[model samples]
Target: MADHTIGTVADIPQGTRKIVVLEGIKIGVFNITGKFYAVKNTCPHQGAPLCEGSITGTILPSPPGEYVWGRDNEILRCPWHGWEFDITNGKSHYNPHQCFVKTYEVSIEEEEIDTVTVDTYPVNVEHGKVIVTV
Candidate 1:
């Protein structure tokens, strides 16, 4: 596994996401409530650009005649098929067990790094950059 610097925290504000390509693999990095999360941009249903979808919440289950809106800005919806997924876990809202999108680990680097080794060579980078591990 290797770490790739996607962008800075300021690049993606809170409740927003940024699409990044690491080694040709497109991934979506999201910032929710000051924390960071990442998921593959490919939707499991039809390979749609999942990250490009809306960053909104969904209607939760309620009583027979009631509906509740919750998880604001934590849902990632596929623009192609309306497939909804949790940005925090990349799990499909329909069926979490069998249907889901690939997720990646994200980290915020604040330490002074000597060099960033990507693939094989070292790339010079500064601190406080968001890194996605693949």
Candidate 2:
């Protein structure tokens, strides 16, 4: 367990992600909206490089024959097997409780002087970069 300053927030846009190798271990850092999340790059299923997969939302039926997509840029699908995992917590869409990807602790080193309002709450200044510790 160590802290590695992978990158800044601006490096990965709102709908994109960045991969950083720490101590020879690959980790995926994602920027959802403006928040940051980090997860182990290796997919629990078949040891695929999870960071190289596609990022999208989840589709569920709102009613009979009515499907709706939600959580845009919040889900990651493995390119190899199409396994869906939530970027927020690294949980597998299928068996989230039993089987899931490993999520790492992430924190942003923001410039404390500036703060921005998000909805009603205030978001700390991120200094245009993201930092991940794994």
Tens digits of per-residue lDDT for model 1 on 1-134? 79987777888898888888898899889999999998998998888888999888988888998989999998988999899999888888989898988898999998566887768544454596755544
- What 10-residue stretch in candidate 1 is worst by lDDT? 117-126
Structural RMSD, model 1: 14.6
Segments of candidate 2 deviating more than 4 angstroms:
111-134
Going through the candidates in the order shown, the clash numbers are 0, 6
The TM-score measured for candidate 2 stands at 0.78
